[model samples]
Target chain A: MTDMSTRWKRTLCVALTGISIVTVAAASASAGEISVWVWDKAFNGDTMREAGEIYTKAHPETTFNVDDTASQDDIRAKLQTQLLAGSTEGLPDIVLIQDDIAQKYLQSFPGAFEPLSDSIDMSVFAPYKVAAATLDGKSYSVPFDSGVTGLFYRSDYLEEAGFTAADLENITWDRLVEIGQAVKEKTGKQLLDLDMNDTGVIRMMMQSAGEWYFNEDGSLHITDNAALKKALETYAKFYQADLVKPVSGWAEYTGAFTNGEVAVVPVGVWITATIKANADQSGKWAVAPIPRLDMEGSVNASNQGGSSWFLLSSSDNKEEAIDFFKTVWAGDQDFYQDILIKRGAVGSLLSAREGEAYKASDEFFGGAPVWQNFSTWLGQIPSVDYGTFTAEVDAAVAAQLPTIIQGGDIDAALQAINDQAQQQMQ
Target chain B: MNPALLRRGLVYALLSLAAFISVFPFYWMIIGATNASADIIRGKTTPGGALFANAATFFATVDAPRIFMNSAIIAVVGTALTLVVSSLAGYGFEMFRSRIREKLFALLLLLLSIPFAAMMVPLFVMFSQAKLVNTFVAAILPTVASIFIIFYFRQATKAFPSELRDAAKIDGLNEWQIFLYVYMPVMRSTYAAATIIVFMANWNNYLWPLIVLQTADNKTITLILSALTSAYTPDYGMLLFGTVLATLPTLVIFFLLQRRFVEGMLGAVK
Candidate 1:
């Protein structure tokens, strides 16, 4: 009985070993499919699938496996965990990463991603978008949508306050605060909705002046960053003037503007889709250039949120993935026009801005050439490095926003932000 | 009115209010599913005529059958293995009464305090080395001997009478037969309650499954609904519809096993 039991155990161990080998062998290779991980199925996922369809028509042997099963947070965690573990066996060929957080991943896990500029032309895309993901003199991303900032306002409310769309054009943050106070008094409505937790507006203001949380050498640029201090003071003036509506989260933030509780939404061009989703407010809305900071180097244009496509260095189908990206994302202008009209995505391909879809006037924005104006502003956006610690610093800034808005000293708040962010970065 | 009657009335009113507060979100979700995405975003309370449209869109977008099958297989298999292994270990620790085993059990409870996020990298490395990434087996294996479930069963086993095991032993029953014929039949309510809890947990499991299961076709209902909600302009109607469907299995499991759940609680208390 003992001899039989020993023999059984040995056979079972051998069988388990054989099974593990087969599973490992099966996992290592996917014959021809180039897998891409994207977050939004409606926007990036379906768009990439369409791009894949376009590619497959030319080369039948190659196929695309576009997986949008994970959230952006999930993708970040998965990528960070897998890359940190030094395991590339299950990593996808391509993944879509947001523009602001791209530097964090690139710097943290160096050589984990394939630098695309070696194969694709970096200059064909918007300069600001390209500059976002470029690291150590090498560009690494295929720029997707442009989050070019725009001042989307209700025309009826502005007119009720005796102001025209021209009054909103190329205004400064201080001037906008004045306009907001006046509009609130005249129309009895809030001028803008602000989420205290979100530091997008502050970042936009800082970027307009070509400043970031980090200096050129990636040191902490807080406490003495003139542009950021000015931006915070400008942000405080909104609350001091009593012209902003305090809201929380994406749903409430967008709801405040869409339901007409607020007059203006100075946000990314991607909000065009959300704004346009309310078809009843179509002709009532119009777009203008986002306000700049009252600083020496500030411009009227700044960016909010955008993302880029990255190829993994560990990808087995690296060559095909790059070719697929070049053919559809980088090379195709008509593809940009299609996605723009269909999904309201503003692509960053500079040449695509001259496409007919961009030039066509929209009746929604009161028949204004909104796309044309957005493209023009896209070029004027100052390039900032968006260093690795933007997320950490943004949290620090968010922590101090409530204090600053309540008439606190900007210098004291800046010191608090610097201390907290410095601790977090460690 | 009598003061006793007044107190009873107040208690009833408070209970009703508490119940309403608990159930309002579920009601709102149903109403939102029947409304357009815009109306839902506008915070409309009234139901509209979009249920069929939302259902159609959800079905078209998600492969409901395959995804449901994947969820069912993982949840069912995971719950079964968890109940068996955890119950055996719980029984062994309680019945055997050794210092070393007790210390090992204490060590496991201590290990449970470490967050899953901190252990995810090492766990992934283990799975990747074994080439179990992107498989249901990988998702289920690590979860089969859940420390939380084992702790639960260990506590519950204290209430289990040891007299039955001795009674079965004098009747010429071996340890395995005693466990099968004596303890198993007596612990029906406990097992029923555990089945519901474990099944619900496995059904709603998200993070580890997400990290392990990579393919779209291999996704669960939770992951699918999460992806839908994160869209730039999320279709609220379809998202709520998917949520309603996703919530039904757990609701049904709870509904069926609630009687046994109460009984199991009563047994544990005794």
Candidate 2:
């Protein structure tokens, strides 16, 4: 009986081993599908799917294995590990990386990303967005969205405060605070919402003034950077005037404005869909240019929360990736218009801005030709050197935000930021 | 007697309150799964009628069978190996104690203090050279020789009766045979507790698996759920539903083993 059992066990194990090898062989023999890694299922992933459908219609043989199952943090972890491990076999041919992180990947692992400047015309994108992807004159991204900041105000709430769209057109950050206080008093709604842990407002304010945390040479310029200090002071003024609703995280931030408890959201163009999500209030909203910083060089235009596509140098399908990006992302103006109308995605492709969708009015925002407005403002965004140390510095700035708003000394705060950022950047 | 009974009542009330506090998040998860995404984020604490819709979306989007299979393989293989190697070392050190082995065991405990983040880069380099990158083998191998499990097994081995091992030896059984037959069956609850722990740790593992599992085909449930949440306009109902699904296996395992693990108290006689 024991001998029979042994024979059966051995036979079973042998069959399973054979099955495994056969399956692996079959898998390897099949035609490879393009694997895409993206964050944000509803936004980027769905948009990619729409693009894939368009491409697949032309070439029926091409298949896509788009994986939107990993969040931003997961993508970072996965990409970093694969690069550090020196194994790029399983990496997707194309991956979506946030604009803020483009420089980090470019510098940390110098040959990991393929230079797209040779294939796609970098001048076709917004000069500033393209500049963020450049290292040593080799730009590496197919710029996807324009996070051009806009003041999404409730038209009803604004009208009640005796302010028109033209009133918001060329306003400074100080004027916005005064208007916020007046709006709060008149409508019982906070003019804007703020998160104590986030530096988004400060970032928006500084960048609107064409300034950054670092100088052109990548050195810390916190103390003497007039725009940054003024941005800080204006951020504090909103809190001191009690015209802001304090919230935490994305959900709370959105909830505050979406519930109509806050009159306006001073954020990126990407928030249009999120604002439009309240269908009942569609006609009540309008887009205005971002408030300018008090400093001399500050402009009314700045970018935030944009991402771009990079081709992996080590990918087996590098030529295919380059061809795919060039044909659809860089060349197809109609495809850009389709994505914009359907997904509210504002592409950086300059030629795409000449498409019919760019001229169309959005009924959701009171029939304003919002895209035309965005394109005009996109040019005014100040060209700043986004140093690789931005994340480290951003964390330092976020830590001091609560204290900075509570009437804390600006110089002491700057010293704290310098001390902490220097330690972490090491 | 009356005062003592009143005190016992007070203890039960507090215990009930603590249990309620611990279980509220799980309750919220289930409630969220039943509601629309918009309503849930609006802080709607009550359940709604969206459970079926959420379930449909989850099933449509995900490869449920494949993900659960991947999770099962890692947990099973990881659990079985961890128990065998760790228990042997534990028994060996306790039964056949030498000064060198004791010092080595002490050193292993100190090594545990070094954070996982510091070791990740070096470990990735080693795995890449061995051609184990992006494989289940890479994920399982690093955790198989877990010091925490070794420490646990050693602590449990103290309660292992010396008399049983001695009798087996007297009966002409070898050390291997004694360990296999006497120690294993006697320390069943210890194994049970370890299985629950290792399974939970392997199941909910995020950062390491995110780094190691390169292909979407090999990615696990946690990775999938995380990706879903990162979407610009995440469907919270679907996400909460997916999380509820991911959490069940560990919850079920703990529910079953926890009774045996707790009731079979360690050092009760000692």
Candidate 3:
């Protein structure tokens, strides 16, 4: 009995000592060091690193540590877990979150993120981008990229189908369906690739008409949303016309388009880099304004997946991190031009569109001023309040996609989406 | 041809087809590493002449040596510690039976049903309170007491003969000495099998380590590879090259331990 008691005491002492050692190590973190967490090393990560260099050039004592070791999903999980646990020891000074899901993070974990409008000028960014991270009249994000929608189609394939670039400009979804059917018949290829699990096209179509899954008061807007019903009807038309080649996940989705199995890819401007990487098809592709839904208020422009930089309130170097974002991200037009040319990252700064890089014509798209066109459309995209339940509603839409594609009733599908989203929101 | 020969040929053909299907993705990965990113995206199955370029790009972009070192240290240290602690506990539970200990062991099996995601928040809080966040100790500590490994060792320990313990006792060997010199030598095969399973688990561990390891310099290859794959314009050639390099350690470990690993499984069954 005495031996067991002594062993237990020794174990307790050792455990306490071990914890103290870890505490001492953690306490030795250096001052003036701001760490930023980003997911894509090629795009945002390297951009942030260059921004850090620019900042450090001016303030020699301050430094930046940018870690891009986690994927976006992984970073989201880590951040959500740490924030929910209320332990901020391992959180980075800054993180990049997608604009669509920003509301979820902002509303669920209030006061966890620092509102950047407190320090930076929010008016300098595109209004739609700023509106995404704004809540209760306080904006929390430094706007980064603009995922302005574009209808990237193969000029060669469209030409084979006897259509001009003018035919694609400012078109509606019904006109796009006719064009897609013509292209498929003439070229013996599918017009586009659609993933059943992705509701990106539907969301883009709805947002083009200034509608979302929720109304201004954050209530479900599914049953009577005319824009949504038209979008779903358009989505079903592609499958009925046999113009869409079904694919799964990012690789297969991109592969279908890249391998020339499909012609058109209606995606964000961010995919320009991916489309341009196949240099053999340099002049084969052209970008047009995205097709709007056939609705009362639909427009030619829309937005898709974009992201913004957020500062964590728990940051030890909060002031330095804010200054770094201000100096490099907001004020530097030349830096935006560099990332635009190098990484194809289109920044949301309205002034950046005036830079020489954004105005220049590209031989890749047969000398079309694609960047200039993208900048113009970026302005006209209608703003909508993407409520905290975009992901839940997106999943609900995806669940009904298979049934909808099989010629199921559009009203029934919307009802099903409403039911699923209602259950998930709870 | 004889009917038996025809049946044998059919069976062989089916086995070959199954093997090819099983190994195609690995073959595709190798071919992908040898091709340009554009070619891979185009779904080209044939090998191309871009292997050296892909390797150069991967090495240029990734801090390969540092990331591999971090993975090695965590997996090696975590595996060794887990083996010693879990094996000891397993042996104790099987040999020195008690009602409370048995109940505790049963409760542990039930605990295994709870997913890691459910307990991640509480575990993070505990490590944060200890101020061990971002340390290798934090990544290694929570995994060292893995209940699945404990259950594995416990079941294997049942196959350990009681006569060996009795004979060691008659030879005046203490419990600790018997555990070390007698039981350990006899259970070498069991240790070999557990080493592979535990090492693989530690090497591929993603979630907890991603949450714990904060700095880029401290990240493992798994996390780095995942980040690479999620790039807006992912370079498949460079990404697959990193995967081939990352897979080598596990392949080498399995190759070295396969003979004893097989015997260990047979012993457990017996």
The model with the greatest lDDT is 3
Model 3 C-alpha lDDT per residue in residues A250-356, reported as the tens digit of each score: 88898888788888989999898778878899899999999998878999999999999999998888888888888888899999999899989899998899999
**DockQ-based ranking, best first?**
3, 1, 2
Determine which window of 10 residues in candidate 3 chain A has minimal summed lDDT.
Answer: A20-29
Stretches of candidate 1 exceeding 4 Å from the true structure:
A1-29, B1-14, B268-270
DockQ of predictions, in order shown:
0.50, 0.33, 0.51
Candidate numbers sorted by TM-score from highest down: 1, 3, 2
Best by DockQ: 3
User: Ten-residue segment with the worst summed lDDT in candidate 1 chain B?
Assistant: B261-270
Give the higher-TM-score candidate: 2 or 3: 3
Q: How close is candidate 3 to the true structure, as a TM-score?
A: 0.94
Please give the CA lDDT of all the candidate structures: 0.88, 0.82, 0.89
Error of model 2, residue B256, in angstroms: 1.4
In angstroms, how far off is A361's CA in candidate 1? Answer: 0.9
Which residues of candidate 2, in runs, are more than 4 Å off?
A1-33, A56-63, B1-17, B264-270
Can you list the residue pairs that collide in candidate 2? A40-B231, A40-B232, A41-B231, A69-B227, A70-B227, A71-B227, A209-A298
The digit string of per-residue lDDT tens for model 1 on A382-409 reads: 9999988999999999999999999999
